[model samples]
Target: GESVGLHLPTLSVQEGDNSIINCAYSNSASDYFIWYKQESGKGPQFIIDIRSNMDKRQGQRVTVLLNKTVKHLSLQIAATQPGDSAVYFCAETQGRAAGNKLTFGGGTRVLVKP
Candidate 1:
């Protein structure tokens, strides 16, 4: 399938270091937010998510922070590694959970140097 939007911006960091990827969304009505990671030539995979009711959420090695006030969101990766290198982006949805579709941000590419 064709890509829906433009390529992500890039962020480079060293291995074993912490990586912080940020995003600014435009929808204040969007109640649900998600962060995704996409490797080269592949589809996006989910990392973490937070609803409008929450400010922060965490996964195994990743953390997602949402600031509804400024319509900003961020992803923090602990101990960056080669495998963690990929394009990261934020997606948001509103209205009915079943009917809501995700709207993705431009994206940011994270390069982890060994």
Candidate 2:
């Protein structure tokens, strides 16, 4: 499914140090990817993105690595902080009219230690 937003609400923990969330897309033609960080009670905010032509993209504290071969993506955040605590979402978009149009991945709730 393309451009699906938080159709469901949920939350959990970060455990000792790390956690991994997974997503499956229904479209095979989508060409770009983005990860967004939305704090509690706030709208989603952009974190990072990678195009179909690329396999990985990195940011200051985040990395968006894409596996076009499998239509898979993952984000890495270094030094998870309490401020980093939020609902994280990944999105994919096709490069055409309404190209800016986006479909978001199911979100993950991340908790940080004090």
Best by lDDT: 1
Question: Any residue pairs clashing in model 2, and if so which?
Answer: 1-26, 3-102, 3-103
Cα lDDT, model 1, residue 55: 95
Cα distance off (Å), candidate 1, residue 40: 1.1
Could you tell me every candidate's TM-score relative to the true structure? 0.90, 0.77
Best candidate per TM-score, number?
1
In angstroms, the error of model 1 at 12 is 0.8
Model 1 worst lDDT window (10 residues): 1-10
Tell me the number of clashing residue pairs for each predicted model. Answer: 0, 3
Q: All models: lDDT?
A: 0.87, 0.71
Stretches of candidate 2 exceeding 4 Å from the true structure: 1-21, 96-99
Model 2 earns a TM-score of 0.77
When summed lDDT is taken over every stretch of 10 residues in candidate 2, the lowest stretch is: 1-10
Candidate 1 Cα outliers beyond 4 Å, as residue runs = 1-7
Whole-model lDDT, model 1? 0.87
Q: What count of clashes does model 2 give?
A: 3
Cα-based lDDT at residue 91, candidate 2: 88
